[model samples]
Target chain A: MKFCSVCSSEVKQRIPHGDNRLRFVCTTCETIHYENPKMVVGCLPEWQDKVLLCKRAIEPQYGKWTLPAGFMENAETTEQGALRETWEEAGARVEISHLFTLYNLPYISQVYLMFRAKLLDLNFSAGEESLEVRLFSEDEIPWDEIAFLTIEKTLRQYFEDRRKGHFEFHIGDVERRVK
Target chain B: MKFCSVCSSEVKQRIPHGDNRLRFVCTTCETIHYENPKMVVGCLPEWQDKVLLCKRAIEPQYGKWTLPAGFMENAETTEQGALRETWEEAGARVEISHLFTLYNLPYISQVYLMFRAKLLDLNFSAGEESLEVRLFSEDEIPWDEIAFLTIEKTLRQYFEDRRKGHFEFHIGDVERRVK
Candidate 1:
């Protein structure tokens, strides 16, 4: 936080009185702003017997496969964030099922929440954020080419649990980088 | 946000020169910070058919009853956030069932994503954030004295959905003051 939201003045990073943590206090209005890390929520959206996935059109992981997901909007819940991202990126309407996975990355200051969702319908087209939208059966997942380790991990866990008819939720930090 | 994360000097707000949106341009280092809202995810833990409740020991909702819930930590997902809150506030362990409710409260500058979880074990007490912890059957909920309307809404929905085994999901903005 470099500029004050209230006064539009330069912000200064300092240890506020009696507190030993970093805080951004506006130099002009003396307003202290707390920076909260953002969250990205989505689902392993599943159709009749297939799971929906998106190929990224944007950089960072352009052309790589991923689940439809993104950052939470200002006034949106995690489910809405997930569903909205699904619609935006893959044009798929989904019903969120169970809360499936929570990937927390404290080092990067981000959290990704994934759910097991059911596809409402099959109609889909690539949005501005996606290169393509496709459904993959359990045996068709491009495991090696999936976008992020987070998406890959969620998918792998989902498929394995789907077979055993037992769902064991897993939590891990994504440390994978796109080549 | 214009300025460096380390130096707090003016950078740039990624908008075009004539963008009407409220934006700041840093005159020093050229780094842009996009300020976004943070999400608070939590859960309402139920044990042996009894709903878990807590008495707030801190301000905001001090001295009132509530479900165990809090902000999503950078170290966990939304489900983990809910589970962590349940354990932290009620000293209870729960298996998160479903994404129960999604609340959008722009006025409060918060979006609370709550889940419905069944207690893995019934033994629980108030954690450091509460003065007390206990369980109440649906009929015994402290409706009028609940700390946050979000807590009350979550519990109410859980019971309502519990009927007919129709544990679907709903999204809406609830405006009720606990005071």
Candidate 2:
């Protein structure tokens, strides 16, 4: 941050009194702008033996397959945000069963929460941010073309649990890939 | 936010194209400032049959008892943040077992994740943000002076689970209290 959002004054990074971390402190107002990790919430919508995936029309991983997910908004529960993102990107509705996977990406400062949900019906289409939306069975999943590691890990654990005849909540950290 | 931190320009709230929510858009640089919910991570330190509680030395609930938790910072995992908070507030080290309770407070746009952790040792004292740090058995908890509903609910559930001899992960929403 270059300037204070409150006073419009230039900000400098420094550790304020009684704080150990460096924060953006305003020169005039002395307000500290703290930044925290953002949450990405979505749903793994299930239909019979298939799961929903969206072909992104956006950047970073355009045209790649991913579960319908996005940055969670304010004033909403994680379940609500997951449902909203699922509907917005896939134009599909689902009943959230429970939180299935949580992955913390410390490299990008993001926490991803993916819920297991039951698809209501097949009347689904791509939303603006998606070029296409479709269901993929375990063998039909585009494993190599998945957009993110978090999604890939979640999908892998999901199928593994499915094969075991039980579903359990999984949590782990996703370390940055060394290039 | 009244000003854009990017360019120090005045900002106005409006729905950006292809977006459904109102965001602060910079008048000069046209930067869209999006705000989202934050996560608060901490641990319920368990030693024998007692859990640890910290008396606040800060505002909002000064002097009220609460679990040692604070806002999750960048470049850290949830487990790491929880461990840090426990050490910072109670001067205690812990071995985190698993996530115990997840509470969504939509009114305040915060998610609280409390892990059930084992207190490593009793060489603990109050940290800077805590007036006092002490362990309390189920019957010795100060229910009336608890700082937040989320903490209270977690403690109550912890004891209930202790009685049941089986602890399960919990997830729920904390609605705004009606006064």
Candidate 3:
């Protein structure tokens, strides 16, 4: 940050008293601006043997296929955020089952929380942030064209767990990028 | 936020185009400052049949007892953040086992990720942000003097799960207060 959001004064990167890491400290007000990782909540909406996917209509991988997800907002639970994203991105209603994946992407400062959910009905369409939305069975999934590694990993694990006749929570870190 | 950290200009809250919720948008620079929930990483540090707790020396519950936790910083994983907090608050090294509880405090825009951990050695003391640190068995816990509801709930669940002989991951929301 170039300036302090609280006082609008210039900021310097320095470790504060009793802290180990460097933070943006304001010159005038001495306010420290701390940035933390964000939670990206989404769901793997399922119907019969298929899962819902949205084609992104925005930048940073536009037109790529991804599970319905987005940055979680305030005043909502993670499951609620996942449901909202599913409804908003794919216009689909889903009944959330359980949290399936907790992938920490330290490089991007994001934690992806994906849930296993059942689609309520066939009444679905592409929302504002999606160019198209469709349901694909395991055999029909466009695995080669998936949007992100986290999504790919979650999808793979979901199918594997399904074949095993039991579902379990999975947690791991993703270090795909160095920066 | 009153001013934009990017350009040091005044920010106004408005619903940006294509977004349902209002955001702090910079009028002069047209920058949208999105605020998301942050992760508070901590651990239930165990030594034999007892768990460690810290008495806060900081504001917002100065003398109340709590598990060692703080906001997850950049360039670190959730587990790392929890370990760092444990070492910093209790001056104890711990071996984290598995994530035990994921509590969403939506009212305060924070998510608490507590892990199950084992104390490495007997060399432990209170850190700067803690007035005192002590180990307590389940029956010896100070149930009335707990600092936060989430911490209390986590501790209760941990003991219950232990009694049941099966520990499972927990995810829930806490709406104690509003901003």
Local accuracy of candidate 2 as per-residue lDDT tens digits, B8-100: 999999999999999999999999999999999999999999999999999988999999999999999999999999999999999999999
Worst 10 residues of 2 chain B by lDDT: B170-179
Candidate 1 chain A has its poorest 10 consecutive residues by lDDT at A169-178
Q: Interface RMSD for candidate number 1? A: 5.0
Per-candidate DockQ values are 0.24, 0.93, 0.84
Q: Candidate 2: where are CA atoms >4 Å away?
A: none
Candidate 3 stretches greater than 4 Å from native: A177-179, B177-179
Badly placed stretches (over 4 Å) of model 1 are A14-20, A95-98, A118-122, A166-179, B1-35, B41-59, B67-69, B73-109, B113-141, B154-179
Output the TM-score of candidate 3. 0.97
Task: Show pairs that collide, candidate 3.
Answer: none
Error of 2 at B80 (Å): 0.6
Estimate the TM-score of every prediction.
0.68, 0.99, 0.97
Instruction: Estimate the TM-score for candidate 1.
Output: 0.68
Place model 2 in a CAPRI quality band. Answer: high
Task: Give one digit per residue, the lDDT tens place, for model 2 in A19-69.
Answer: 999999999999999999999999999999999999999997999999999
What's the residue-level lDDT of A178 in candidate 2? 49
